[model samples]
Target chain A: AQTVTQSQPEMSVQEAETVTLSCTYDTSESDYYLFWYKQPPSRQMILVIRQEAYKQQNATENRFSVNFQKAAKSFSLKISDSQLGDAAMYFCAYGRGGSEKLVFGKGTKLTVNP
Target chain B: GAGVSQSPSNKVTEKGKDVELRCDPISGHTALYWYRQRLGQGLEFLIYFQGNSAPDKSGLPSDRFSAERTGESVSTLTIQRTQQEDSAVYLCASSPTGYRNQPQHFGDGTRLSIL
Candidate 1:
């Protein structure tokens, strides 16, 4: 069984600043994938970024990037130039190479202050 | 039609009653998933459907929960003898394929309340 943990229950970032949300997971599988999802008040879950365990290089999507440390079982998401729209509940998820299920973390509520 | 669609955006039912939540995945998507998200908690996997493979029901919390997907189209999650604890947001998602790297697009979710 794989478990994802987000130690921070809530976080706040000033507008135009950068913020990093931490995530860690426990999985025995050598090959897997990590993902960060955002859910706004609308309750719509949106994919933020993803990292492949096999790829040593971290994944970056514009202002959104991930610091993936496979050896440490850590995958953290960094949001640069945070905006009000970035204020949402973020969840970290893990999925094995051959599995269809994704294990999710409890989530961290992020508030972007103006 | 464009993204995953779930019907009855909100549902309220009494205890011991049965309820069904529907999910319509994106066209041409080969994978569908069901998840439950309780208040202030993370999403919990409920069931998964990929192509013609046998659905994975391992994440279902109890026997009271059952889901069925017809081919690669619509899916329904049924809860029998619903309990108060069953009140949560039922979410549905679908991916182009079942591959681990593929991103799953999600629906707005149905807010189920068992009174």
Candidate 2:
């Protein structure tokens, strides 16, 4: 069984500043995928970024990027130039290549202050 | 539908009553998933469907919970003798494939309340 943990329950960043949300996971599988998802006030789950365990290089999508340390079993998400729209709940998820289940963390509430 | 669609956006039922939630996946999507989200908690996997293959019910919390998907289209999650603890948001997602690399698009979810 894989379990994702988000130690930070809440995070805040000033507008235009940067913020990082921490995430860690426990998985025995060597081949797997890590994902960051955002849920805004609308409560819609949106994919933020994704990183593959085999890919040593981190994944970046516009302002969202991930710091994936496979050896440490850590995958953190960084949001640069944060805006008010970035205020939401962020979740870290883990899943295997052929598996349909995604294990998710409790989530980190991000507050972007003006 | 253009995206995953969950019907009866909000449903309130009495305890011990049966409730059914429906999901319409995006056209052409081959994978469908059901998850439960309790207040202030993370999402929990419930069931999964891939094309016409045998559905995965391993994540179901109890025998009272069951789900069925028609090919690659609609899906229904049924809860028999619902309990107050069953109050939560039921979310549905669809992906082009069941592969981990494929991102799953989610629905707004059905808010189920068992009173």
Candidate 3:
């Protein structure tokens, strides 16, 4: 079984500042994918960014990026120029190759102070 | 629907009652999944269905939870003899294929409250 861990339960950042959320996972498979999902107060889950294990280069989508270290089993999310809208519950998810289900972390609540 | 769609945004039921939650995957998706999110908790996998075959059922917390999918389209999650612990948000997701590396698009989720 694969497990994703997000040690931070809650995090806060000043608007326009940068914040990083840490995530680590346990997986034996070499081919897998990691993702960051944001769930706002509206309870809508949205995809923030994703990283493929086979890729050495980290994935960046707009202000969201992931620092993926496959050997260390670590995948962290970095948000630059954080905006008030960035406040939400961010989750780290793992998906092994050829599997449709995703294993998610406990989630970290991000609060942006304007 | 353009994205995975779930029905009855919210549901409240008494204990021992049976509740059904529906999920309609994206048009071209071949894989669908059901997960449960307890208050202030992470997502707990329940079942995974690809086409008509369910490849995994290990994540279901108990036998009270069961889910089924028709072809590659809609799916229904049924909780029999529901308990208070069953209260949570049931989420549905779908991907273009059942491949694990593919990104799964999620629905708004159906909040189920057992009273």
Candidate maximizing DockQ: 1
Encode model 2's per-residue lDDT on B12-71: one tens digit a residue. 999999999999999999999999999888999999999988999999999999999888
Clashes of 3: 2
Tens digits of per-residue lDDT for model 1, B88-115? 9999999999886599999999999998
> Where in model 1 is the C-alpha error above 4 Å?
none
True contacts kept of each: 0.84, 0.67, 0.86
Q: Tell me which residue pairs clash in candidate 3.
A: A98-B100, A99-B100
**Stretch of 10 with least lDDT, candidate 1 chain A:** A94-103
Per-residue C-alpha lDDT of model 1 across residues A1-114, encoded as one tens digit per residue: 789999999999999999999999998999999999999998989999988899999999999999998889999999999999999999999989988888899999999999
Question: Compared with the true structure, what per-residue lDDT tens digits does model 3 show for residues B1-115?
Answer: 4888899899999999999999999998988888999999999889988776645888888888888888888899999999999999999988887764577788999999999
lDDT of 3 by residue, A1-114 (tens): 899999999999999999999999998998888999999987778999988899999999999988998889999999999999999999999988877678899999999999
Candidate 2's C-alpha runs over 4 A off are none
Decreasing lDDT order of the candidates:
1, 2, 3
DockQ per candidate:
0.84, 0.76, 0.79
Q: Distance (Å) between predicted and true CA of B29, model 2? A: 0.3
Top candidate (lDDT): 1
